[model samples]
Target: MTDQPLPGAYWRLWFAAAISNLGDGVFVIALSLLATRITDSPLSIGLIATFATIPWMLFALPVGVIIDRVDRRKVLVIADLSRGVLVGGLAVVAAFWDVQIWMLWLLAFGLGVGEVFFDNGAQTILPAIVPRDQLERANGYFSAAEVTTNTFLGMPLGGALIAFAVWLPFGVDAASFVVAALLAASLRGSFRPTNSVPSTGMIDDMRGGLRWLLGHRLLRTLALVVTVMNLAFATTQATFVLFAQQELHISDNAFGPLLAVIGAGSLLGGIIGGKVVGLFGRRASMLTAALTPVFTSTAIALWPVTWFVIAMITVQAFATTVGSILSVSLRQQIVPGQLFGRVNSIYRWFSTGAMPLGALLGGVLATAFGLRAPYFAAAALLLIASLLVATGLTNAALSAALTQYSPVTTEPTFATDVDTEDHDTDDTPVSIDRDPLDDLLAGP
Candidate 1:
């Protein structure tokens, strides 16, 4: 299974996501730049970022349930097409008249809603396309394409496009989404979940997904570690601009290129992720991911030098990307197909839910203890998170969780599902086992 080439459809999916992310890269920078034209106030910018993220906190669970019930491909197509129209409309308006701050906020929220659906659908559809043995490779490829487009190429292109015209970047984003929708449509097979049943009410379904994830020892522990790490990372991100200016004395112009180091590192990570995971195994790979940020953050706190920050964050980005590839592949392996969307969404909600709080904390801590304070605080938090990962994500725990946990199995309705059935081939009922953590917590 590992030696076989991925299917043609998988390549198509990969290209589509990559193209879409390229536009996303441009949009991320351009959107904030456009908002600055409206007003340079940090509050206005914060509002834009806030609204864009609000949908994730608000809609992730419901959208997850929706992904499970509907044809997942349709969700992806609809999400892209809708976003295409929305951004296209923004381009038209911006070209004709002055863009209002409120209008930008509205567009951001709309785009966020679309992302909530597209991302979950995209993730949920993968196991259907690739064999379980190949998930790491598949995810690594997807991650590489994404980081290459969105960050490496997208950010700079976005800045240049904005310089060309206020409306140009939005128009480009619109075109990309339209193209992505077409690519999604070209995928030849059905993407409905194998184990999905008729709807049992959204709330009940959502609750079921949440309960399952919370009860699972591996998933639960992973989510906690990610949440804390994300908090630390986001805090650093939120304060970085100020920290760079005040502490490192990085001029405005050099900031973007310096930040690009993160993208470069992620690109390198994505390319190497499968091999690293293979060589080191999941526990050590995950531990490496959790610990690298500690060193990077501590360096920033201690030195506040521009070149040092760039180098350290580059390493940090690589480590984080490796962690992400492995963790996502692990979840995709174990979670039930019918429940993947809901459970995955719930897991992410917990994992990234700290972002807004961290953003706020970064600002407050920066003001209270100075720009470097956030960095120190982040390093301390990440150190705590690293220790948790070191202790919790052992090879034994991962092995036990993989063997003990089971996804709901159903008869295949689609051709591809039948072919891939052997990969998900078990219909064996797995009884509940005592959580591995209980034994660990009992101190042997």
Candidate 2:
């Protein structure tokens, strides 16, 4: 592996992800607006958002096994093609036909199903395309691209475009998917099957992925932290709508600009994650890691006006940016290459599975208690997770746990089930792309 991404493959992934996430961002904001226009109930929108996790939760594990056993490139192409059709077909229904709330629910269900394959394939396939040491850079680039779409371009563009024609955003969203599918079609490389574990049956594959995750203490801890954060954050999207409507006194469709502002924050945060790892040192990164969400959450709890709310949302995006880079890079650095797909699948499943409950709890709290209450709960949970991680692992230990390539690493393994980057029993950054612990695995 080299320090930079394989130029061609990386660009291919970049274009595909950018176009797809852009469409997704646009569709999500538009969907929220559509639901509100069709019915006055915020709760319905909230419920719909809650169930958004169903695809990831239900299909993730199976998708992981599939990613492991099949050619990753093929998986991506097929998933993108399916999604393009679905989005385009839905656009017609939303644009021309009458759309019921239940229909929207059904659309969500189908979209969720495809997401399982797409999301799993994307993350698991990334390491194969880039050099090992570039994990931070790769994660940063990916997050930055997504932020550009959802925040800088997609969310605002989608909402603004919708004012022209209700179907415009949906149509645009559909178009993005088609473009993504085409881009995916060009990526080379068939994740060639190795005789390592020998492809097994479905139930065995599931058990293998699960068993791998449970076997490692660091990964176990990391999974728990990620799951908790996701559960707490689940209430965020629903509560944000309430806050915009009631507290800020804004219309449902007008928050697109604000969301875009957050995208800027996310962009900055993501760019800094790579620099932060080098400057602050990974050990010190943990305590500082807690600040962005804390800042974002506390400010939102204060109930600012539209401008202030925009700033707070920006902070949340920034926090998400940094958090994503740190966690993802850490996992990529540590996880065993062979089982990386399986372990990541479990992680996705838990996060997505928790989303529905989080959404429901948020909606309930807003209607029964108050709109701002969910923010308080979300902030508290983030704070707690931060504290637990700090108290449990020393900074040096934590850094090593995250970046070390040895068997001491707790993340899931890669497909090759081997680490051959630096064969010596040394424990330092071996090269620009190779970590000291990489040679421990019996991989290709």
**Considering every candidate listed, which one attains the maximal lDDT?**
1
lDDT to native, each model? 0.72, 0.64
For candidate 1, what is the TM-score? 0.87
Q: Which portions of model 1 show Cα errors greater than 4 Å?
A: 1-3, 36-44, 239-256, 367-369, 406-444
Model 2 lDDT, full chain set: 0.64
lDDT by residue (282-329, candidate 1, tens digit) is 889888888888888888788877777778878888898888888888
Question: Estimated TM-score per prediction?
Answer: 0.87, 0.85
lDDT of 1: 0.72
Off by over 4 Å in 2: 1-8, 399-444
Ten contiguous residues minimizing lDDT sum, candidate 2? 435-444
Q: How displaced is residue 438 in candidate 2, in Å?
A: 32
- The root-mean-square deviation over C-alpha atoms between each candidate and the true structure, in angstroms, is 7.4, 7.6
Local accuracy of candidate 2 as per-residue lDDT tens digits, 1-444: 134333454554565566667776778778777777787565676677655566677788888887777765566667666766776777788778888888777767666676677666667655654556677777777767766766678778878877878878888877776666665555433453343367668778888889877776666766666666676777766656557777888775677776676568777876676776667765455445554566677778776667887787666666556666777767667766667677788876775677777777777877777778887877887787677567654676565665555423333333332333422211111001110000000000
